[model samples]
Target: MLDLVSRPAPWHQPIWQQLTAQQDFAHAYLFSGQPGGGKRRFASAFAAFLMCDAPEHGFACDQCRSCHLRLAGSHPDLLLLEPEEEGKAIRVDAVRQLVDFISQTAQQGGRKVVVLQPAEAMNVNAANALLKSLEEPSAQTYLLLISDQPSRLLPTVRSRCRVQPLGLPAGTEALAWLTEQGGERSREECALLLQMAGGAPLLALTLAQQDALAQREKVVEGIKALLKGQVAPSRLAEQWNAVPIELLLDWFCAWTLDLLKLQQGAVEHATSADMEKVLGYMAQKLEVQRLLAWQDWLLEHRRLFASKANLNRVLFLEKALVQWKNLLQRR
Candidate 1:
């Protein structure tokens, strides 16, 4: 049981209306989207609606018993299946438990809902274990599989669910929503945050709240220092170890792409103006092909990091930084 409010964001209205207009639902739904696109939030709200004693206009009646239970985080029929820890795989044991949960009767005498977040986090064994349930789901049981990377799931598993792709909001809608949520950022700052987040409003709001711009500046400065031979890769890796590796790699990837774009005279489309000097310097020093290769490497490493591969973070960063430094030494 998790305390989840069933308020859908503004962008969710159309999808909600479409989904709720249905009299019957597929046993499993695969909500696929970029990170922070609100798939999980929509799934939660839908689950609440399914369990509500009285649903009104496609939403859960907040005053009902099931809704109260849901709000109190005591919903007897709602099961949330996620990784035990961030970046860890959802193990077979968890799927076994989910199977058992599905076998039992719904305590509320209504629908039973299971929300599996980042469905790609399920290990191979766990995914295989969950497949049987999906193929032959029990009556009145709804499984919501929310994934940022649906391609990582097995073909068999993917084939079983009704895939719903969620897209980012329009730029103006995203910026307006972010401004309302973040409260303190200027329009320019909000726009930058939205750009950094690839136009995902929730992610932009999170970055604004976390002062991610300052952190990004530090990373850019480190790269500048690295290029100038002012710091060693090992030292830079040590300094950056406290930051999330995924975020660091993402920023590095963006910077690498920006450098390539600058080299191609596409500066207008570049995402980081604060790093204009660094990008220009790198664009001049590194060949476009080399920058593209580095961008590919960054993307590969980002996937590895997201999959929670057992790589030594400091050593990995050191290797990347050393490669970056060596690029400057090339003709």
Candidate 2:
């Protein structure tokens, strides 16, 4: 069974209550938020509430037959639409299927709901196909669209729905939630995870579960070794074969930003403790123009990674590292 949230996260409680108390519901909702900020969970919970046969106090009645079906992942009236593969575009055929689903009467004799996540993943053709459903509201049918980057979505598509934004939770609230979900993780570890996640509790938990901290430590150590001439960039790139390229690019981008900030005297302290010294030394040695040029190159490749460009990961990493190290060389 899909692990649907029973209710909104604590940070979303007020908005949940407000939405539940509404007299009229929109036919579609666009839930926009950062990843791990509970936008999907909120959308799922709202879908459940919409389909609940016997909603109690603005929440799903778990005892109802409809709730039972949902719990078993066999809810006939509900559909989930997303890309077949991760990081791939949602095809027009899938949106066509959604259009067909929207036209059909509810099998459960109640509301029909569709949850389409990462809505920005829809290509032009797919998004245009979806627009038809948005233009003509089907009776007792609702569509919940979730996106981490709503700006990437078509303006027409975004304008059609009631846009709901979910912000990152307060630091203390995030820390508390992460602590509770962290299992054996110490408070300090959870705090570090939270920092790494940019105060997104669910993401912090996910990173912890993935042992991302250990992975980060390994990468940092390899960088130190490479800088000290103990390891070649090619060797380091090969060593990091198991690490995700997107994550590596993200870290590099972040480090580049930090280096820029330090060089410009924009901040007195480094935000990343693991690379404080490394970034500090680079900031001192590298010219600002060279660093800016490197940042542009890193960002361009990062965009390519986001677009799922078919470049060799090993070669990319080797090239990235060589350029990174060259930034410190005398002009």
Report lDDT per candidate.
0.84, 0.89
lDDT per residue for candidate 2 within 199-226, as digits (tens), equals 7888888889888888888999999998
TM-scores for the candidates: 0.90, 0.96
Model 2 — which ten-residue stretch has the worst lDDT?
Answer: 1-10
Cα deviation of 317, candidate 1, in Å: 3.4
Please list all clashing residue pairs in model 1, or write none if there are none. none
- The best candidate by TM-score is 2
lDDT of 2 at 264: 98
Tell me how far the alpha carbon of residue 30 in candidate 2 is from the true structure, in angstroms, after superposition.
0.3
Error of 2 at 190 (Å): 2.3
Q: Model 1, clash count?
A: 0
lDDT of 1 by residue, 224-296 (tens): 8888889999999999866777678877787787877778887654567777777677677777677778778
lDDT of 2 at 291: 91
